[model samples]
Target: MLSSINNIFGNSKKKKTDAIQSAVVAYSIRNGKLTVLNEVPEQSVKNVQAETNGLVLTQGFHKIGGSFFYFEEPGLYFFSFPFQKNSLRIVVGKDAIENALLISNTIIRGNKDDEQSLKHLKKEVLDRFLVLTCTYACIFVQHILNETGIKSRLVMTLTAEEENQYNDGHTLLEVYDTAIKKYVLVDIDKKCVFESDNGEKMDLLSFTGAIKNEAKIRIVSAAGFPKLDWAGFCAVDSGFNFQFIEQMFCYDEQQQLNLYKRICNLPVIMADNKYFSVSSATEVKNSWKNKLNFLPVEEFRQKFYPL
Candidate 1:
């Protein structure tokens, strides 16, 4: 996986050395009142005071770190003088966006075991962590495809009732491969593509079903995180079986292989050898659990426990 990821980015040219630089100042309106976050003294606004709520201009660029633009409706606005000389204008083109996303992935790369931080978190907070994990995964996968020079965007699984009644949805990455001139539907977590979706039996397998189901699905902006109540991750019956236990109970590759082998040797019944007995399921589960250093729900407490 690491080698494959390297091969993807290695193909792309390094970002340009001539980095654009500027300073930004923004004012937002919430609840019909203009407000500035910084507690600037009233006298500081003498030079740039806006007599009305039209637009404001600044004098020159100032030192600002990690340049980016962000705005939201009913609360935030990316305010700057459009025509003024030396004023901040967000220059986030496609290449810039791609670079930012790649940088984020690099930060998250060495921290796969970082789930330890969730230890002792309340169930409310743990739920939030799961939402964040999936959301970040969606963004990471989309950016990874973009960095590889493949055209892709995020998709949401929504039912007719969901569309009619609710405003929630699940995130999925859909990519367009120029070489094949076809679209590929991908679920990054399962690491598979859509094999079939008949509203009853949805198959998420790799490589096969994408070619037959090539259609121009409407894409939406990838902004906010997805919710747990969303269709894909909501219920096991929804056909997107999220393996929460598998993710929470992580194992290294060798440990996983060893567990598989051990379970195979047991007297557990098997369904075509792909399934195991539920009667001894507790024993099998506990065996793997013993290998981990700490419990999932009480990892922090484990540290203080007596030997």
Candidate 2:
């Protein structure tokens, strides 16, 4: 299903247009009514050539580069691939993310700390009355970027004190910046970044390696959080609150950060009919591990929980 969606939304020669719509990728196609993926805007798609099996076509179906068309016939058909990269630069990504965060701020209201809270968090998201949880924040952003062919994921942050019960736990996102061919960690909701000593924006794995080495990291934030509805969700709403975070982390004697969770694409964050396609947990975890390239000190021999 993912592959088929990717192919249909795949990039190819598109006709030039004076204006581009902030529409998302195709979501569901039941009874010939195409539902666009939620919020994940495809602003770059100027035109698309739709067909069936490279041969058959329905009446009013687009045969060439057409921005607007009609699907008059009804039946189930396959789609193309997903995650075809978009070439728009610098500000486009930031603007898209900020816009997404603003929307998330208004909807989801609170942060869901661990598995226990997720039970209720899931219900809140489906209802459109959002709670300010990092998990769902990433879910929203991941799909927004995913629909437009930008790669991203939902990752967890766990504390080394395994018995702490996730008091220090957090969740963040790792977005693949195709321009650099590297994944960068995003504070997601607040539009901030994790950086190393050299002032480079760090990916989750790289930051994990730095944390392993007892190195310091800088959390650079943008201006501020927009005035939104769910201002009460402190944990998520304080994304740019570096002082708050630093004060919280000041107690850590050895490490500046807690153990980072191996990438879990959030296989469980499902929606009946919205945006983002969930992938297998094993698949996302392995992909994250493979990206590690050079292995860190594997102290957790039995199970590699952290780097």
Candidate 3:
């Protein structure tokens, strides 16, 4: 047991080197004003002061960090700056993005886990850590993808909880994989993507469907993390006919694998443009108690887009 934990630690990502790479700075409007998070602070803003080409920043801009000027505004915004060191020749296609997950892989993983209280770090996780908690890695990678013009959403996978156990719900990303022509789930914290035995990538709903139909599915490495190291960490249904999927991205000798396995009827909410914002955090959603509104996805789409 100790050896497995030590092995995972030994296989974790190495620290960063002093090479200049691209930059990603995130902002949210706090107290009716634009404010940059200190964890992903003003200093991380490299060279995005002005508009690039004709992109206009679409929504209103603000000077949260010291990197930009004349951009005073209020309220939260959900937009990502198209990041590139120089002129970015926009790729044209029905799928206008590629290599998003791979590009993010080079930037988001980190060895450090002090994400919440990382107020004092100069620059936190501009690149690499497989050991960071699921939520932290998801949020950072979401921003990086959005910054680079890839569409992604936050997905919370819930499972049945035991009386005294914590680690039931987990957060990961639902990224639009162009090759699949649909969204697929990617677990950056685990350095893996969920897939079926036939080599098709899977989103949460699809994964649940495969499990329901008694099909073979598995997790494959996104980076160089070996498949053998990550095998057998997940136990679906927990030896019953229930629709539960409990996976352990973290190394635990005690076998607390209930991280991000999926099941129907869990009914997770808050997947939208603001999915990455703090205002849409999972804990905040739990505070609504029973008054939260519910809607059918198909019906909701038909009513909203009745064209």
Candidate 4:
């Protein structure tokens, strides 16, 4: 079913309108209707294309986009792939999350320090949310640059601490700030990245370079996958390749509990429907290990848990 949806939605061609391509198109998907808001201040608001079943037809034309649709909407809906160079991605905010919570406290309801909690967390958050980590800490931040009405792409980078072998893997976003004419590094998970020319502060490469002691860099773009590619209760995209993620390691359930409790207070918030398609526990574990070496979940808990 997901494959069929992808087959239809994925069939995109080059659009002739540069205005639509570079414009910040506001979109919303509700009750199977996909609507696009493309209007100039003096111009009347018009829907360029309205597709049934909420599949985005304009993937290649626009590099940046926004959606007002709430993920908590209970129904089957197709999400356009985030693989395009200038594709628009949805933002997961607080209100939408809080609203979902009202419907079901089970969204994020569990103790942060138990293996059961981890399972519930995965079921509620990890499964739906992509867990992005950097070198120091896992922080979730949000920032919207209103500079040009057109949204910009954000690049989320992951660099290994040991060899500094990094995978640019995934477009956290590709933000084009033409007015500033400067590169901006956004912590997508944190949802906040201050726009500044201070190369030293927002410089992820510099920090990794200092640790790796190498000037040369190798990075891979980890583009987020569409809903079809993700493993879920109903559908599965077998062709979807799971990358970088490996088995999650722990001595026992106790350790797992500790780790969960440790990061519960951190800036991480598991939003709705942000689950990963890779539902395998082993895969998640391995991915966690690959990203952050087996520093014993217990160690983190011991370090951060209130004494």
Best candidate, TM-score: 3
Residue 221, candidate 1: alpha-carbon lDDT: 13
lDDT of 3 by residue, 36-61 (tens): 53332355544444453321133222
Q: Could you arrange the candidates by lDDT from highest to lowest?
A: 3, 2, 1, 4
Candidate lDDT scores, in order, read 0.31, 0.41, 0.42, 0.28
Model 3 residue 89 lDDT score: 16
Error of 3 at 41 (Å): 35
Evaluate model 1: give its lDDT.
0.31
Give the per-residue lDDT of model 2 (tens digit) for 1-307.
9987776555321321211332323332332254442321245333444443222233343422223333333322222222331210111233333333333332332443323343454443332344455666676656545555666666554333323322444567766665666667776544457788888878655565565466777755442433223334344444533334334433342222342322221211112322222222233333222222222234221122222
Let me know the TM-score candidate 2 reaches against the reference structure: 0.40
RMSD of 1: 21.6
After superposition on all C-alphas, the RMSD of every candidate to the true structure, in Å, is 21.6, 18.7, 15.9, 19.3
lDDT of 4 by residue, 180-261 (tens): 5433333332232331233322223232223234232222111121111123212123433332121121233344223222
Per-residue alpha-carbon lDDT of candidate 1 for residues 180-219, written as tens digits (9 for 90 to 100): 4444444443332332333221211111122123421221
- Candidate 1: misplaced stretches above 4 Å? 1-132, 159-168, 196-307
Ten consecutive residues with minimal summed lDDT in candidate 4?
A: 220-229
Model 3 Cα RMSD, Å?
15.9
Q: Is candidate 2 or candidate 3 better by TM-score?
A: 3
User: Candidate 2 regions off by >4 Å?
Assistant: 1-130, 166-168, 223-307
